[model samples]
Target: MSTINTSKRTIGVSFDESGRAHVLLWAPDAKQVELLLSGQDKTVSLTRGESGYWSVETRALQPGDLYYFELDGKKQLPDPASLSQPDDVHGASQALDINRFRWTDENWRHFPLKNYIIYEMHIGTFTPEGTFAAAEKKLDYLVDLGITAVEIMPVAQFPGGRNWGYDGVFPFCVQHSYGGAQGLQSFVNASHAKGLAVVLDVVFNHVGPEGNHLQEFGPYFTEKYHTPWGNAINFDDAWCDGVRRFFVENALMWFRDFHIDALRMDAVHAIKDFSPTHILGEIRQEVDLLIQQTGRKHYLIVELDLNDTRFINPVNKAGYGMDAQWIDEFHHALRVTSGQEKTGYYSDFNAVESLAKSYQDAYVYDGAFSEHRKKYFGMKTENPGEQFVVFSQNHDHVGNRMLGERTSQLVSFEMLKLLAGAVLVSPYLPMLFMGEEYGEKNPFQYFVSHIDPELAEAVRKGRKKEFEAFYMDGEAPDPLAEDTFERSKLQWGLIDQEPHKTLLQFYKELIAIRKMQQPLCVLNRREVSVEHNTEARVIVLRRQHKLQDVICLMNFSKEEQSVDVPVYASHWCKLLGSSDLRWNGLQDIPALVPGELALALPPESITLYSNKHE
Candidate 1:
């Protein structure tokens, strides 16, 4: 390892005070490196400096100019830190002036993480146009649904037009099919204007197979560990310093340049690092510094499989200091209780008690023996409720299915409303997948365009193999087919239909209740209590904030049941009921209860009641 300058940005192209473009490339193994501009017939040889860094200051190539690096005058590749890939990942890298985009969100400020009601969306399937510009037109729709934040799937450049976005190889470049760099800037600006925070999902575990030129530049992957995708990203290895810088700078680029409110780091359990300073910890430290400098708030949320508190724990406690993480246990337990097949990881959870445990304790498997892995798994976390983002259906939960059937398609209408209540009324932060509010019937199947025939066939075979454990009888949908991606597109026209219209209104009311109700809005696990019955398949949760108290009663059984209620007040006022006729359910349930010992609950329904102070 050699000492390198940390003050200046040396891994990418930057414009200096003299308005000259300074190009930097880290190719320690290559003996020669040359810069090739798109239109110019001549190639400029870069001067190699210390620590295998090559650089050149040029005024000939201006912003928006396409350029490539010719290594050893043999292989010409796009810049690893390309800001714009206008011609897809395999083509030339466009020089983007990030400062050129005039933003109207100067006064916009991010709210607390606890207040976030996230709506996760994939840009391509979010609208018919499948671009950032098209998605911007739906900001008011999100606001009307009471969403405080929008978490977009990975925008990093992949091989072709359509993808779920996890296959992105170019970490810095926005997806060309999604209207590129300028498109994202405008979307973020529009999101901020609509008072919606933009949370960008970023993949740090593995890059996509095709058009991945990181290995060509340096030792970006390690042979020591292997991920499900392929070789794990080289972190805490021989030449890990440069690899660490590459990703850390990528995270900062989203915040500083694109004005992204937060980053949802994808599958962090695959990030193999055994260093003294963990990669996540380092990213958090740098983000904190950026927050202080910009006087704006930013968050780092992780999609982790391991139930480890160290990721969300503060750095002062020798933890990674991630602000929040997605809690899949909640979703698993909720689904299992909703009659999901006890296959794969779902076998680990069985009863309504698991859902109750998730509500009380953040992790249900906190140091418990796991039947899934056949070993003790997870650590207990005394973290606040807001530290966990709970969702009934996300991209992975839906798209990974053999048929990509959403909860809406699998469960009945009443059960859908119950699931919504179970998530929204909980103490944890709530998130909803795109088109889930209106019960869109279209499946969100996994789709990709790899451009390589061999790679495409491999993906098709791999998708079928993944469903082997579930004992799914039919053939899995072809991931490489164009119609697969087309079928996944959300049908906006469905919102105006019979059941869809009612479900959408129900979601609006539910979200409004979550926002306006004091006990529901305030995320405090300590102020919550859970009670359930295994036989009746009923769970009652009580959440309190100061003097406010709200109770959520959920019936997971197929038939109507009655459960004893502990009266803490004179009576319990009905806030919302899934059985209400307004939501297309039978209105047989009462609006108010007068200190009743037992209350009747409709089949597969959830009812909310706030205690009367009198």
Candidate 2:
């Protein structure tokens, strides 16, 4: 064995200028490394270099070549950094040439946070075919719906054909069932051509339980800290530098190789790293450097439960300096207020007051004691910082329920319109779940396809116990059932129906209003205020920007209520009303007269008024 440079490409197969593949593996514990070629008995020996890295170069290897690594002359496994897995997670790794695909998005410019209206989608359920190619057909529909960016759920390779994607084992490989790497590249290219940015969701907390081969390659996990999935990923212990580099490189690969504009990190709170510099901070710093080198805008968003401002606070201010984070306070408050089951986390929210606080501040329980957790939670913050991503419904919020019921099933159409107004017109970045704009009746259920029979049985039992607290009506659906996954697929034809079409039109109108009205689009926290009447169950949100002012009045009660306006207006014009007869409402609402303190609000209706003479 000869000592070689450790800084060289010592992970997955990398291609040189001549198109020859350079294969490398990190196996300090193995004394012998052999590359097993597909459909051949011959094996190539790899030389061990410094830092236990084994390296070998050959022209015989090319894109789409299937191969595996044999450790100590036995125990063959897929490459830890495999870029494409044509077979399932248990099959061999296939080399993919990312440069082969020609891209026409070189002139596409990345937009900033102020221009973002994110639409979250799961590719498997977004269309009937459940493939990236199938999803490419919907790009025009999303663009027409006012979505500037599409936040895709995790596409990392998992065990079988169906999964929610959080339980992925191969962080580098795109799911083979979703058209593999080539399909993903085509999808991204199609999106950019249609003027839509792609935001990919990635998980670094813990690897999936099935087909996780990283442990055999290196110490990628540790018992020092435990996560809900299993042992936490090693990020701060001995030889943890490789572990950190692996994940950070994965994020960069999405931006540099896959042409992803942003990454929405899943469950950052579960990533327990007590190092001097957190992994999130390191990822952000590396992404920043990539932005400068490529001259393209990139963003790092996180899904955190801590509600800590440090996630978005600048690093100079002793924070992680993330671009944005998904805040669930607004969702929870809206869910509870709109008459969803309020037994679990909903107990912390009192609806009207909590919604008011959510509009005024990003977090309702910032530094406040929680009865649910029985301890002080969250950091205090004054403004939303335009770094909070607000949504009425998403994958977790809908699929995690006992029955996987959507907000449309849980609340009336009027309440749904009200919730849409609250999220879309807010100062923070707004996101919509798949089919939400059309009021799709199909539920987004929790489904999985695990190969292990024993593990599959255990998953079914665990799901039943988890939803017991909610006291749901029907029996919980078996997660391993194929019918469960099929039922969760979005019904695309629903948009042509009567009520669904009307609701879809209403959503389009609301988005148009948000974009056309300058006061509604301004993200300044100082210009926004919320006032509500507890007894009448009506709330008024005021937004003022220089000479322009807008007010959104919402009635949560079942019966009509008279709301008082404290701020006098010289002239007011009705921009939109959810209960208007145009939107399938029974009553016709008239514009408010000037100097009128008492305004009649229809039951469960939301009305927006623009005061030009304020």
Candidate 3:
């Protein structure tokens, strides 16, 4: 519904059923173009069109007016397809009427991406009046902690008002301190009236050098590929089809104007593009024609450190269709089996059988050999497990740590409930960052304000030279400090104390035993299976699904092993344990009898079990 294209070779602020205000701009190296138009003092000129787009219709403009763009009338800027900058990001660009907000989520719908649980917040520290109407007053505490979708993170319009939004630069405005663009269309209509689903997190691979005006609206960037947040977003240049239709119309203006149901994308292997289709397969064939003209459901989910399954494969096989991704090898084999440090790329995840090969393959370097980017990595795809999106405290594994601690400050709340039972009984698609369910002891650091004092001391000497090889306590928090974004917010009064209310009731009893377990809500990776002991550090998995099967066991050791598992057929039962004195643990190992193979395991725990049918 919102690939916003006003019949006049559209580019930015549209309007027309004779209500006027056209305004386009692409700027083929701007020879002239004007608009200024706020409270008008005359300046309207545009007409260049013919493939360099320039437009300008006016009835003195309409929808929320306020404008910019002058170029060659002495360079002004700020409208590389802006929908609303509401003054900042170097000011003016606000004619936002992509059908002005009013969307009571037309019966919202969009679920699948393995029926998401994703939480991943950061609308400025998830709250402390961090706007988007204070994170929609915590969406009923993330739908009472069973969160279905939230994602967020990048909100575009970055620069000042403290960021972490990967320094966004008006990729269709929004973040005028988080409550703009109709406060993200009323936080996606209150997350679709509480059923959830929002996603977002964009950052189209490079465009944040403070208020960057997309190269004055022309060759949209590219000095011949190079990214690390610099250039490389020309996506195959020479007026790259109006910069790939202005980022596939800003990812279909957040699923046709802010009804957003998915878009993670950030860092698609730094989106270089050699053309021949692949602007992420032309944004998945234009969001599959906007989900066949808005029957809803959108999704995209990328974020690649190149374990490439051709970006979630299948677009007639040549790949890049994308529906899911973000598989950091099961959070680097569960943080090197919960004992952390293996150094960069965690030295190819020092085995715990790489967490049973990322639970029977979702990619643990499918191509192998990568002692931290030394070569031969990933590319073996049979993509499943909800096309991969696993997590264990994200925001770049806890704000690219150094001091932004948290895996509950580096392990042990019984290995953070054994890494939340290996990410909610893995079959993929699980995510939780914002205060990780209920253990939020702050520290999601890496804040920013960047009113560029030499880009704020090169982002505080590049985050203390990228965390000077770990071990940080005292000084590293000034990410241009606002008390490091108020010590990275989320201390919602420590969720009623005591192991954060017993890890928020063990993450709401493992998301209510993953929705009353049917092999943990089916995403069928051929009914999964793992089984590893790695010298009694223990691992187990097994799922199944149709008539149920389960089994799960975890224990990444702190000494409490027993092992002998696998025998998922006859009588099992004990569903959900994370070491159980009602989750404050100490032991509660029940049900299991298949030639009674001793199983115990309580130190760093996780249990599960099931059985049924036949």
**Could you say which candidate leads in lDDT?**
1
Q: State residue 346's C-alpha deviation in candidate 1, in Å.
A: 0.4
Estimate every model's Cα lDDT from 0 to 1: 0.90, 0.86, 0.80
- The candidate, 1 or 3, that scores higher on lDDT is 1
Please give the distance, in angstroms, between residue 443's alpha carbon in candidate 3 and its true position after superposition: 23
lDDT of 2 by residue, 1-614 (tens): 11222223335887877998888777767899988877766678889987767899987777888988899877999988888877788788987777677888999999887778999999998998999999999999988888899999999999899999998999988999999888999999999999999999999998998889999988889989999889999999877877887888788888887899989999999998889889898887777777777898888899988878888887888888898999988899888777676877889998789888888888989888999989988877764546889999999989988889898998888888888998888888999999899888888999999998888889999998987765648778889998999999999889999799999888889888888888777788888889988777788988888887788889988889987777777767888989989998867767755764467899999988887642
Query: Candidate 2 — worst ten consecutive residues by lDDT sum?
Result: 1-10
Pairs that collide, model 1: none
TM-score per model over all chains: 0.97, 0.96, 0.37
Best by TM-score: 1
Rank order (by lDDT, best first): 1, 2, 3
**Backbone clashes in each candidate structure, one number apiece?**
0, 0, 1
Candidate 1 — number of clashing residue pairs? 0
